[model samples]
Target: MTQRNSSFPLTRRAALAVLTSALAFGAAPRVALSSSPLDVVATTGMIADAAMRIGGTRANVRALMGPGVDPHSYRQTRSDIVAMTRADLVLWHGLYLEAQMEQFLADLGRKREVVAVADALPEDLLLSHADYAGRHDPHVWMVPTLWAQVLEGIPDLLAAQRPEAAEDFAANWAAHKTELAELDSYGSDVLSRVPEGQRVLLTAHDAFGYFGRAYGFEVIGIQGISTESEAGLNRIGELVDLLVERGIRAVFVESSVSDRNIRALVEGAGARGHEVGIGGELFSDAMGVPGTYEGTYLGMIDHNVTVIAGALGADVDPRGRLGKLATGS
Candidate 1:
C-alpha cells in the first residue's frame, strides 16, 4: 500500500492508535474493526480517500486498487479479500464500476458493511451503462457535485456500522462537503471561459458523462464504458467520420485505457482530410502517480479541466491550485 500522504492528521497518538490497535487486536479484534474504523477496505483510491476524509482518525483506509489499476477489470487478491472480510465497512464506487468485483461485493454486502458511494448519487445525473441495460453510469465521482453527494453517503454508511464515531464522521463529512462544493464552484468558473461551441470533450472512453453534465461540455467517447469491451471497426470508422465532419481537432487519451482506439480515430480522420491532435491525457478511471498533483480526486478533475479548456481554446487558467499543471505551467 502506498503511504497515503493524506493531509489528515498523523500525530504520535494517531500512529500509536493505528499500530497498537492493529497489532493488539490481530485476528482477535476483527469484530471490533468491523464495528468502527480500525481497518477499512475501499475499492478505488478515490473512494479510499473519501473514507479517510470521513473515517478520519477512526479508520485506516486501504485501497485494493491503487494508481493506474483499472477498476473495471480489478479483482481482489486473497489478502484483499481478507481485508474486505475483516473491514468494518467496505466502500466502493458501485453502479457497476467494479465489473469484476461485483459478485464479491454482493456476497460481502450480505455478510458485512458495504456501501457503494457513487451509487448514492441521484439517478438522473447518471448515463445508463451500455453493457448493463437500465443501470446508470458508475463514474459519478468525475464531477465534484456528484462527488459531494457520494461523500455525504459515507456518514450514512458509517452510521449503522460504526455508531461510536458517528458524530465524528458527521463533522468530518460536513467539512469535506464544503470543500467539494468549493471545488465545484472553482471548476465551474474556470470552465465557464470555454466557448459553448468549443466545449465538446472527446476522450478515449465514455467516462466523462458526469463531467459534461456538470460543466456544459458535449462529452464524446471513442469506446464504451467497459475497457474490457473493444471498439469495433465500424464504431471507429463512424467516430472518424464524425470527427472530420465536426472539425474536432483534439481528442484525449485516458489514464486507465489504451490510446489505440483514439489513435485509430486520428488516422481515420486524417485519411478523410481532418488532422486531429492528442489532447492531454485525462484521469478517467484512475488517478496520477502518488505524491504527484493530479493524484487525488480533486487534482484529477483540476487537471482535466485545465487540459480540456486549453486544448479546446478555452480562456481558463492553465495552472491548477497547487501549481500542478496548467497550459503553460
Candidate 2:
C-alpha cells in the first residue's frame, strides 16, 4: 500500500461515531435547503453519479476528480479545497483508493460531514489484496452487486442532514439497486459467452479484480491495484510471454491510466510472434464525459462488458443490453 503524505487519521472508524451520533440524534449540520441546493463534493465520478441519483433535486454535486483523473495519485488543488470546504456534504471512495488524498479527507471529516461510501461495505465480503496483509481492494464498483452495497451508505449519510428527503433517497437507491442487479446479470450472461479458456482480461492496472471475479474471467494487470505502483520491465516481459503462450488476442487500456505499458505488451508479444491487438479503452478509475451515456455507473460497466465480450469473441449485442451504448462500442 502507498503511504499517506500527511499526518492525520486515515480510516472511516475514526469518524464513524461522529456520523452515527448525528444520525441518531438528528443534530448533524444540515445542508442549507432553504435558498440554495445542497452543495456536494465527491472524490470521483462514480460517487458523483451516486450522489446525483440519490440526492435528486435536493443537491448539487461536484466531482473533485474528473474523467481520466487517476484517484490513486490525485492531489487536491486549491480549487478542490475551496469546493470541499464550501460544500454541504463530501463523499469519497474510502479503502485507500484515493491514496494521496486520504489524510486530507480524514482531516476534513473532523470539521464537516464527510462519508466514505465504500467503507460501509462488510469486511467479510471484500477482497483482500495479495500484497497488503489486511487492506481491501478499493475498486468495489467493478462488481455491480458489490457496488450496490456501497449505495446503502450514501443515502444514510445524505439523510443525516436532509431528513426530509430521506424517503426519496431510499426509493432512488432501491431502484438503482434493481438496475445494478440486472447489470450484474447482464455482465455474467454476456461474459460467459467467451470460452472459459479465452476469458482473460488484461489491463493497464489491477482495477478489475472484482469484475473478473464476478464474471468468471482471469484478470491480469501490468501494474498493481494502485496506478501509483510501477509496472516493471520484468512484469511486462512475463505478460508478453503469457499473451504469446495463451494466444490472447486483446489487451485493454484504461482511460485514467496511461496506455504506454499496454502498447509495450502488444509490441513485445509481436516480437515473440504473437499478434495481439489493443482491445479497447476501458473506463476503470473514471467514467466517460459528464453528459454521455458512458458517464453513468451503469453505462461505464455496460461499455466495459460490451467491449470485453466483443473482443474476446462473445456474441453480445453491439448496442448494450439496455440499448444505450454509444455507436462504435
Candidate 3:
C-alpha cells in the first residue's frame, strides 16, 4: 500500500474485460442452511453500495447507517453491536466516522474479519480531519478512484470470510470495476463543462474536497469536515460576503445534514444584494431512500452529477448521463 494518486484507472478497457470475464464465470448464489446471502455489514450507505456493486448475487451488504442517518453522530445500538460481532466480515468507513463504535470495531477485530475501507486510501492526499492529528478523510467513497480501491478490497474480505466463495467474489469484483470506471468518466465529463472561474462548489460541509480535487472545482463548505465543528455566525457572515462578491447564484445542500446552515447563507447573501438559490441537494454522507433508483451507489453519484451539472448551467440534462437516470436517479 504505497502512496497512490486517486486518479482514474489507466487501463479502462482492460479493467472492464476483467469484470466481464470474472462475472461470466462466477458461481450461482448458494443457499446456506440459513437461506440468506453472506452476512455483510458496511458503516455507511456509500460503502454498502460499493460492496453491493461488487458482491452482486454472491453476497448481501447492509449499511448500518441508512439514508439521512448521520454517521458522525451515529451511536451503535445493542443489536448493531451484536450484528458486528457475528458478521462474516464487517466493513466501516474508518477515520472518525463511526467514532461511537470505534471500540466495538477494535474488539470485534480480534474475532472477525473487520476492515476500514477508508484506511486503504493514501495518507498525504487526504484532507486533514484535524490539523495535528488524523491522517485521512473518512469520506473516501467520494472519489471514484479511491472508491474503486475500496471495492477491490471486497474480494479479499469476502474470501477471508468464506474461503469457498473466493472465486465468485473475485470474479464479481472484477466485473463491477468497469462500471465504476464508466461512472467516474461520466462525472468528470459533466463537471468539466463548467468554466474554471465558476467552478466553486459551495455546500453544507467540507465533504467535497476529494470530489473537488478529482473534478477540478474549489469546494467551500459552511461547516467543517466533522459537523461537530461549529458554523459560527462570523463564519457564515464571511462566506456570505464571498458568495455575493463572487456573484455565485447557486449553492448545494446535503441530503443527510440540516439545510439550516445553507438557508442562513442564502438569507445573508440576500441582505448583501445577492440572490442565491438552493442548487439542489447532494448526497454527501448517505444515499437516497431504499428501493429507489438513487438508493444504489451508482444512482447516488448519478443524482449528484445530474443536479450539479444542471445547476451550474452545464449543458447536461438533470435526468443523468446515458439516460439511465430516468429510473428515478
Candidate 4:
C-alpha cells in the first residue's frame, strides 16, 4: 500500500445522511411535476454520461468536473454550488472519490435531491482501499463489467425522479447494457492477448485494480488509491528496480494526474540501462473532450484497452475497437 498524503474527515454514513435527508424532503414535491426533464447535476463526467444516456431527454444533466478534471481533489465552485442546489437531482460518485467535495455535497444534500450513485454497488464486488480502513476504491469504472453493474440500477433512480419516463429510462438502459457487454467483451479479448509476463499495468495511481482483476494483469501504482497519496523516493526507487528486473518496457500516464512521477520512473530506469517508455495517457479519473468519442464511457475504456494492448506488444488496431479513437491517441 502506498502512503496516503491526506485523510478525509466525513464518514460514508454521515455523508449519506445529509444527502438522504435532502432527497427525502425534495423528492416528494417534485415527483408529480416532473413532466419536464429532471435538472440533474453530477459530480463527475462518467456519472453525467450515464445520466445523459439513460436519462436522455428526461434529464438535463450538467457535470461539475469536466475533461482533465481530477475529482479526487475537486472542490465545489460557487457556480457549481449554485447549479447543484438548484438542480432537481444531484448525483455524485460516493466512496470518497469526491474527497474534497464530500462535506459541501453533504451540506447541500440537506436542501436538494442528492444521491451517491456508486454507493448502490454491492460491497462484495468492491476492492477495499489500501489506505482507508473501511472504504473501497472509487475507480470501479475501470472494469466495464463492474461499471455495468454500478449502472444497472440507474434507470430506477432516474425513474424515481420522473415516473413518466420510467419506460424510456429502462429502454435506454437496455440498449446501454448491450453496449456495456460488448465493451466488456472487447476489453477482455484484447487485454488477453498481452503475454502473461507482460500483463503488468503500471500507472500513476492504483485506479486500475478492477481492470487488473477483471482482466489478468498485475497492477502497480506509485501512489495509493487516492491521488492525495504521496509517492516518496524510496517507493519510486523500488518500482524502478522492479521495472529493470522485470524488463517492463512501458508505464502509463493519466489524463487527470501529473506525469512527473511516471517520468521519474522512466529516468531512473534509463540510468540503470533499462529504457522504459510511457505506454500512453490513460483516462484514469477523467474522460476526454466532450465532443469526441473518447469523451464517452465506452470510448474511454476502449482507448485504455487499445493503448495498453498496443503498447505492451499485443496486436491491436491503433484506431481502437470502434475505429473512432483519434489518430495518435
Candidate 5:
C-alpha cells in the first residue's frame, strides 16, 4: 500500500476547548430561535441524515457538503461560514475527516454549539490512518454497527440544546438504531453469499476499511486514506500486477473520487491479459443524490453490499435490500 505524509494542526486540547466553550455558551445569542425549529448544520450528509432522523420535527438540518462533494478537500465557502456562525447547533465528523475545515470549525466552535460527533467513539473500534500517524480513519459510516456506536452520543447532544425535546430525541434515536441494526443484518447476510476467495474489495481510495473489516474482506485502495494523496506510477504498476496475479475480476470507482486511477488499473490489467471490469460505482466519501434512497446512509451501504456481492459472483437483488435503490444505480 502507498502512504502519504500529512499533518493536522488541531490538537485534542483545541477540540476539547471548543466543546467546553460551546457548552458554556449553549445556543449562541446570534441565533434567534424563539419557538422555531432548532437551526442545525452538519458538515457531511451522513451526519445531516442522522441529525434529521434523531431531531425529527424539532430541528431543521442543513448539510454543508452535499451529494458528490468530497469533504477531504472541501473548504468552507463564505456562505458556509455564515451558516455555521448563525446555526444554533453545528455537527461535524471529527477525526480529521474534514481535513481542510478543521481549523475553521475549531474557531467557529467558540461562538456556536459545535460538536464533533465521531470523535467520541472508542479508539479500539477505529482503524488507524495509514497516511497520518496517531489519527484514525474517518470513514466509520461505512459500517452500520460502528456508525450506530457513533450515534449513541448524539441524542444527548441534541438534548443538551433542547431539554424539552429530550424524550422525543431519545425515542427517535431508538427507532433509528433499530433500523441501523436491520441494515447491519442485511449486510452480513447478503455479503456472506460472496465466495470466500472473491471477497476482495478494491476501490478508488481507502474509504472502506471499516466495511472490509466488518465483512471479513481484503480491501485495497489505489490512493491512500485521504483523496488528497497522489497515486504514483509505481503504486499503479504494483496494483496491476496484484490484480493479474490474484485473478481479481473487478475494481470499483467512488462517486466523489476521480475514476482516472481506477481506469488506469483496468487498462494496465487488460494489457496483461486479465480482463477486469468495473464492479460498480460505490458511494465512498459521498453518497448518491439528495432526496433519493441512495442518498441516505442505509441506501448507501445497501447499494455497496448489493453491488459488491453481485459483481463478485454472489446472487443479490438488483433493487437492493429495501427495494428502494434504483435499478442499475
Candidate 6:
C-alpha cells in the first residue's frame, strides 16, 4: 500500500464527504479478520485505554496520541500510518475531534475496519458545537455516564472480531461500566458541594461542555470548542470582566492547551482589582502521564472532579478517589 502524505487534512469537510460517499456505496474498506491476537490502533490514549480494558490480553492496542497531545491539531506521522494500516481494527473519536487527520483517517477507513467510537452515541445525547453548525462536541469522555454509554458496544465489537475471547470481553466491559458509574456519582456529588452561584468552571478551551451539563457548573472557555479556533483580545477582555464582576476565584488551564491565554485572564483580572488564581490544570484533550492513575480514563476524570471541587471550596477527600494524585497536578 502506498502511504499518503503525513500532513494535516485542513480541508476536512470535503474529505469527509468522499469517505461518506464510499460507505454509502458499500465500497468502504474492511479489515480481514485473523485468529491471532487482534491488533488495534487507536488515535487517542483514551480510546486505546478502553480497547485494552475490553480486549484484555486477547488484543494488542496502540495509541497514536499520548498525554498532553491535542487531537484537534494532531497530524498523522509516517509511523502512525504504518501502525494504522497494519492493524486489525482502528478506533478514533469522531465528531471532528481529529480535525487535522480526518481526511487521512477517512481514506484509511476505505480499506480497513475503522470506527469512531463516540459515534455510537445517539444524536439527542450529543451537544451541538456552539460555533460550528452541524458538528457535535467530541469531548464526550468528560462525562463518565455519557462516555460509558458510548463504550458499551466496544467490547461487543471486539468480541465479534475474536469470538473465542467473547466471554472475557463481556466480563471486562461489565466491570468497566460499573467503575464508570461510580466515578460519575463521585463527580456529581463532589462538584455539587460548591455553591450554585459560584459553580463556574472557566478553562482555556471549551472542551467541558459535557462536563458542565453533566454536573451543575457553568462552563466558560477562553477559546471555542476546538482549540483550532483562535481567541481574540476582545474575548479575553470580556472573560476577565466576567471574572472580576462575578468574583470568580479560580480559573483553570488545560494540560494539552497552552496556558498563555489563561495567564492573560489572570493578569487581566488583576489589573481590574480582582485577584484570580489558576485553580488547576485540567485534562481536557489528553490524560495524565502513563503508568499512573491520572493516565487512565477513570483517574483522569477523578483528578478533574477532585481538582475542580477542591479549588471551588468543596470538601473532598484529600487523598482523592484512587489516592494517586501527583502533588499540585
Candidate that would win on lDDT: 4
Q: What is the overall TM-score of model 5 with all chains considered together?
A: 0.89
Q: What's the true lDDT of residue 14 in model 2?
A: 60
Per-residue lDDT tens digits of candidate 5, residues 1-329?
Answer: 12222223346568778877876888545334544578899999999999999999989999999888999999999999999999989999998999999999999888888999998898898898657678898999988888989878888988887887899999999999999999999999899999998999999999988998999999999998899889999999999999999999999999999999999999999999999999999999787889899999889989989898889989889888988888754
Residue range with the least summed lDDT across 10 consecutive positions in model 4? 1-10
In model 2, where is the ten-residue run with the lowest total lDDT? Answer: 1-10
What RMSD does model 4 have? 13.7
Candidate 4 per-residue C-alpha lDDT over 58-125 given as tens digits, one digit per residue, 9 for 90 to 100: 78999999999989999999999899889988999998999999999899889888889888888998
Q: Which stretches of candidate 6 lie over 4 Å from their true place?
A: 1-35
Comparing 2 and 4 on TM-score, the stronger one: 4
lDDT score, residue 303, model 3?
A: 85
Write down the lDDT of every candidate, Cα atoms only: 0.80, 0.88, 0.80, 0.90, 0.90, 0.89
Per-candidate TM-score against the hidden true structure? 0.83, 0.88, 0.85, 0.89, 0.89, 0.88
**Candidate 5 segments whose C-alpha is farther than 4 A from its true place:** 1-34
lDDT of 6 by residue, 1-329 (tens): 22334333545767888888878887654422344679999999998999999998889999999999999999999999999999989999999999999999899999999999988999999998658678998889999889988888888889878987899999999999899999999899889898777799999999999999989778998898899889999999999989988989999999999999999999999999999999899999998888988899988999999999988889887557867677554
Misplaced by over 4 Å in model 1 are 1-37, 129-132, 159-164, 326-329
Query: Which ten contiguous residues of candidate 1 have the minimum total lDDT?
Result: 1-10
Model 3 — which ten-residue stretch has the worst lDDT? 27-36
| Tens digit per residue, CA lDDT, model 1, 1-329 | 24554534566569768778777768547656555445778999888878888888887888888777888889889999999998877888888889889998999999998877776667766687566577777778888877887777677676666777889899998888887887788788778887766788888888888888888888878777767777799989888887888778889988888888888888888888899898888888898876666777778878987788778877665686456663542
lDDT of 4 at 154: 81
lDDT of 2 by residue, 1-329 (tens): 24553423555566777878877887655523352457899999999998898888878999988889999999999999999998899999999899899999999999888888987898888887786556788899998889988877888877777777889889988888889999999998999899878899999999988988788889988998888779899999999999999989999999999999999999999998889998898999999998999999999999999899988998888788789998663
Clash counts for all predictions: 5, 0, 2, 0, 0, 2
Candidate 6 — which pairs collide?
29-110, 29-111
Clashing pairs in 5: none
* Candidate 1 Cα RMSD (Å): 8.5
